[model samples]
Target: MNRTSNPGDNQTGTSQRPFRVTEDELERALRETLAGRVAAPQPLAADPAAVALRRARRSGRRRALSGLALAGVATVLVTAGMAQLGEPGGNHGTPTVVLGDPRGFSPAPLPTATAPAPGPVRAELDLILGSRLETSGGEQQELTNVGPVERAQRLPDAGGWLMTSATPAGRTLWWLPPNGSPPQVLLAGADAVAVAANGRQVAWRDGPDLHAAGLVGGQLIAANQTPAPAGAEPVGFAGDAVLIRQPGRGGFATWSRSAGARPGPTAPNVLAVYGELPDGRVVGLVAAGKPGRPCVALLDPARDLSPVRTGCGPELAVDGLGAISWDQRWLLLNGAGKAALLIDLRTLGTTVTAHPAGPPVVAGVAWTQTGVAMHVDATGGLVRVRPDRVLDGERPTASTIDGVAPADRPVVVADAGA
Candidate 1:
């Protein structure tokens, strides 16, 4: 709830800074910080699981804060923390215009001024999806130069530190590079959001209409959604096609691409919702009459795609590559922890023992790039690994292989060579 001026807002004799945080407000500050980190903050899901976990985690602290007693004890601490954020000591990054999209999102009043950013913790690299005309990650404390930033679309579950950005014209898109080159800009923006790593294909939303088949062979292949059957709403999009939820039925249809017939072979009641994978493959969960019993299926339209394999079992991984990404190539899935699979997408083979004998990955297999930058989520400073080398930070080493950004957040820590 504190505010700092834009770091470089100095005109005449005034200087600007970041908000320092305090212990009492640590939780809120942390949440706010993370929320700002992502392109669009995830909506708080309306379910028992989400609420229950939140309640359990805060019960004790809530109980201890008797009325405004703790509030009185922490005023100065809060101020100090805000100052710490803009203290002349931390990493300072380039400026970016952060668009705040609260979940359950209703339009709110815009602030006359922008929120002050904390001193940089990482480098001044452009790692976020909406960070247009900017640099982030890499430094802290130093002042940032502000400018207009835009992100036509944002998604959190695509895995790793990833977000998609579109140009002002809404034509070209630049993706975060796994290798050292600049981000890839394409004329892509359409229904749902699409971003492919291995082959580098991307599509997202612009205004309300969808843009598709962009930047192929250096040309833009554009397509528009030509109205649904009067009642269907868009549910998901893959490549140039979109899946619309049909009215009064438990069915979904691929519109536009229409390459595949509606209600094809798969019954409306037993259809799967396929999402595009990082490697350009389709994956979906085949639902059944039994609400609790859904199965995972790796789909390949190019192939038979007739439910290749079913009942992957509950032992499957949450962060496991989407069934479609898995279907795209044959990678060994060890079925243990996040880092269990050592895959060579080129060979469609397994490398085994990708993780260097360590504790389990409490966090999901949070990948930055497809397989380039990886991390092990531990309590205090987890271990981060990248292609060609492992960096515990005790040892930072660069590599010939280009690394992906750590997450949509930023590469807080990288091997010396990354």
Candidate 2:
């Protein structure tokens, strides 16, 4: 009898694929081998302090190496004529969310999927503090002399940053350049009811009026006056357009900056609206299929408020306003145990990562290209974690942005190349 050989098997009976190890798998195997040859890592319970410190050191080294590898990969991709995809996920179809109907709506549950094997961590963001913007390269700049700053967002082109500062007069908006020039006062009011910006334009709502202006300096391009309604407020600036919320008639009416505060067509059951993505897609918060569960939905501003994706899960709730990554691919929502829920826009996948102690409450959290930065109010600690590892239940490494008591969540400013 003649026997056939399998493609996976060699003449010596060895497997050709050798278990098909990934880069992460190979690194983990090497670490295990070295550990077995010497000694195993100490359990966190045995010595929590020592374990945290050791992990911090190890994490820093790993991040540095990952950054270098990403740089090389990026160079090769540029040379190979392949466009670098910003966030990994899919946008395949147009999903519809009925304006007022509750029946027949069934949202998928939050995914418990583990993060795929992590690639190199791209270190390209600066953590803004009261004092300055601290780069990952350990360089710091005292860009502003403002007192008790409330919020800071980097402008496009690295032209400058827009911040809300608390002065003896009141809460005011200022444009501070990297060169440490005198801050330009943009707006002075009690506090910004709502604020949003795209590198070229800035928009803020104070009292009943919404204002928009250019970053460099110019006359107000748009001013919208919202009449007194039970619950009406500005959502955010979507590129040049600003979104405003109005209470329900049939469903709810949303406003567009380009439309001069005129209410758009009503959509049912739309709870909250975030802002617009770069591609002109509008993102909002709506009740999921399950009652009391909130989810993020991508809707077309010009069309009906239908969802493209709505699987943000039960953990996603915004305390005040929702936070999103600069790339417009991730939505950060409040979670229990001081944790925060991150939802991927392309994939509609969810992940939870928070402090282990779980008490101080996540004061602020920001997402960059490769990972996230979380600040805990209880510990006054700023930690960084790979989103993939966080989904895998790995602890975050203590970040350099420490000691500052943030008034609000800090924002990550990406360099031009990042």
Candidate 3:
């Protein structure tokens, strides 16, 4: 079935179609098939050190091969340009979290359901200044200023676009309401921002310090700010935690502060080596053999890292709330687009849904609340998947900017074709 292709608009639907076959090819077959070359696949020695080295080499190789394949499939996923979710069966939240292999052979049926009429109406966007995006229900948004937005972003479940871009110019934070209505804006302040589901819990930073305030229902509450480290710069925040990346005694340092507390987790370990799963679990990579050498280590702050899944798709942002992919199965590569392959470690559960308008090549990914968007290098667009219904992306037909008027300009942050 010709899967509708539109990364430009919000999300909509069509009749459900069965999933196609898309199996993950081992390195040997993939090299011969995709590249049509006779490059020798690296052999894995039985020893731990040898295996570790082989795995690292494979990870690099996967990243490289995915580049070649990204062009055709990039539109299906998003990238991690640097933001990093969900539930548990326990402290990890009440959901299933697994670290299945992306390479082993597995095939599963793709889920399907009927989407309600009117379709997906609106979406809250998580964007930075100078970035542009549109939603499926016919709404458009743009960052029109050079305001302080390093800490500003949109909450997934909210209706209005959240902002910390508030200044004294009567500048308003806009929220595109559902039901084909006009967008509304609220007056936000210097360090002020709002989360749709949680209203305004605006957080701002002063030098190295971070602060938060909010509107409970309708009452405005004074915000509490978190202090920045003595010499470190504020990288960002997640919930109440502040991230600071600084030069340490040896290498770079990563620090975080939640509430008004001082930063801890003071290790020179670069934060880039960690993966944040949807359940707030932190997965750190630790290579084998070397003392403190980094191979992939799963750390769930809520639960002990011991119970977490280890080693399969070790570097991916494995989820505990929902399925690893739109189809609710492990992807063939570490990702969905062309550049990075999405491989499911699960048993025989592979699917290949047609993505007619994906990117030319994919490298990294950024998972948004609506769906996991891809980072392709030609035309960036979103693939909106309605969990139980069907995994389908959207695009507008009438040149309508997801409902934003011609005056509202949206820039490209996650394009299938970047």
lDDT of each: 0.38, 0.55, 0.37
- Give the per-residue lDDT digits (tens) of candidate 3, residues 188-252: 33332323222344444455554555544333367565565555543333334433444443212
- In order of appearance, the predictions have TM-scores of 0.34, 0.55, 0.38
User: On residues 221-249, what C-alpha lDDT tens digit does candidate 2 reach at each position?
Assistant: 44545443345555465555555566452
lDDT of 2: 0.55
TM-score of 1: 0.34
How does candidate 2 fare on TM-score? Answer: 0.55
Number of backbone collisions per candidate, in order? Answer: 41, 1, 88
Tens digits of per-residue lDDT for model 1, 185-304: 443433345443322234344554433443343334544434334445454455544545545545455544543233222235424443555543445444433553444554544432
Which has the better TM-score: candidate 1, or candidate 2? 2
Off by over 4 Å in 3: 1-133, 140-158, 163-203, 214-222, 230-240, 247-260, 273-280, 283-296, 302-338, 341-418
How many pairs in model 3 have backbone atoms within 3 A of each other, for residues 3 or more apart or on separate chains, i.e. clashes?
Answer: 88
- Per TM-score, the best of the predicted structures is 2
- Candidate topping lDDT: 2
